[model samples]
Target: MPTKPTREQWLRHVLSSATLTDAIKVTATELFLEMRANLHVSVPRALLARRLGRSERQVSRRIQVLKESGFLDVIETGWKGRTAVYVGMFKSRGSDAQRVTVSSTLCEAPKRHPLEKPVPVVAGHRVTPWASRHITIGHLRHGVCRNVSTDADASMLEHVPSLDGHAWRSRTAARLTFSARSAWPLLRDTHARLAAHLHLRLRPVAAHHSTAARKRTTP
Candidate 1:
């Protein structure tokens, strides 16, 4: 009798199979990895969702695809609060000739789209286009000031003075300092702007009256 293919061999075959979609192949790979690591073929949908960074519903759909594709067989059905058990099918069914046909089909390379442009290569490495790799100032500004509390704080940090220049430049060091003396004016200006924007009434303080009251009460 022929020797049975090991789990690793089976996984390699499944991954290379052209009949299966990329999503199904990924799900199968995850399941195989789980089985190898844990010595069990039970993987919860929730676990798969977290591992794959997909919704549970999407994971369920992918699992269903694997089941329908004959890569996975349901050993035991899930019950209340219990996950289902599955066993991976590795051995090819039918005669040697039929197996050869299946193998050839699985090993066939996927066809490329006619309209798709070839990726640019530089020194054996693929170079991504500038447009795709570029990060806009708006994105950088948003990322830096995302944690800022107020609109005034956002406005102050939105655009760096150096970055606004005609020539593009990179800074080695950038620092922003705030002392009471410097920050007080900015705070007062912001308060005034906010008050004017909101049409808020400002109550005047009676500093002279308070000073006179303090003098009268003094020892």
Candidate 2:
């Protein structure tokens, strides 16, 4: 049997396959959950798009991401005139027959996720705290989440099958943070100017991550 994925794995897969930037994944998931609730049969892509005001290509792409991430399963295939209809799998199946037959017992309301917290915004819209290795900024529709990484922060990508409008992105964004140790060089070299540039206070961060002294020797 294949090893079951942990919460972390699922989280990463959802983010990656959704082709969603950190800020948009939660919105995407919520949209998906809302759409999944009233399904009798998985309908045509064009219809789904019209309901959400999203382009048909966008819905199709997200579906492909969901499928590759194991969040959605394809059971049978059909046609609405010329549009293809796919049976969606939200859970495990025993046979090909099970895939086509969706069960109400299997479909459940999406859980209320608590991770969608608000972050400070610039002009009342852009997310804030700037950027740092220890913390990441992501948004969903209007919500955002921020977390700290004590050590070096790492980001990796997962391969998801491509869909007509679905996308998973692996591009890394470079950001500098004014609060972290790695930022000492910029902080020290031009403390006054950098502070003004970033609108940061000139005061020091007490304790300053503990590793501040040790890394002085590091490049």
Candidate 3:
């Protein structure tokens, strides 16, 4: 018979695979691991909040984050006075047919990540944050950019499976605020600023260089 994964193994998988960076996520995952192997656990929000030293709302948000990131599954939702049931899950698959389905969010993640790499402009709109801010400022000055609430924080890219080819991004919400006259100049300035910022940030410092040199020069 196949044995269930130990807590340590499950935690290692979570850390390595999800690259989980938040304390809440870590704590929530730990709680999930304390449950039965089959993940037939019923944890209440208030109880979880108390255990983690967080507000119920915070715990709720953390649970949502876990679900969205493919760390937890909702086996059943609470209705009336019932508590919800959840199953602990990770991004791995077993050879057997009774494995948890991989999350679509993770599958779509790499292809559509907002900051995967620097994108200057897409569909005549500034994609970089600095450039987008500059465009917003320009519009603010002219009172032209309305519907500010509808602004998009990320670019939606077309999914292309080929490695040799590149994918095109859709027209971002920033384009909605743009006029033909100000569009080109705004994009140009934003791209220039972003490039300079990247250059400075990515430039090797003396300490890093010295460390590398020491490693190479050491006997």
Q: Give per-residue CA lDDT, model 2, range 1-219, as digits (tens).
A: 996444344444555542333323543444445433333235667766776677866666655654543455555654556644333333333222322111221244567878667886666332233333222222211122233342221222222233211121111111222347766664344434433433332124324534687679678
What Cα-based lDDT does every candidate model obtain? Answer: 0.56, 0.41, 0.54
In order of lDDT, best first, we have 1, 3, 2
User: Where is model 3 more than 4 Å wrong at Cα?
Assistant: 1-3, 92-219
TM-score of each: 0.39, 0.24, 0.37
Model 2 TM = 0.24
Give the higher-TM-score candidate: 1 or 3.
1
Worst 10 residues of 3 by lDDT: 161-170
What digit string (tens of lDDT, one per residue) describes model 1 on residues 1-219? 996556787688678665566767788888888775322488888999998899987777777756655667888898769998887765354312222222234446898778567877665424342222223334333333222344433344334443421121222012211325545554445444533532322222245567789999999
Task: Compare candidates 2 and 3 on TM-score and give the better one.
Answer: 3
Q: Model 2: runs farther than 4 Å from truth?
A: 1-40, 80-219
Ranking by TM-score: 1, 3, 2
Question: 62-132, model 3: which lDDT tens digit per residue?
Answer: 66666655667889998768988877676654422232222332334565546866777647654443333
Best candidate (score: TM-score): 1
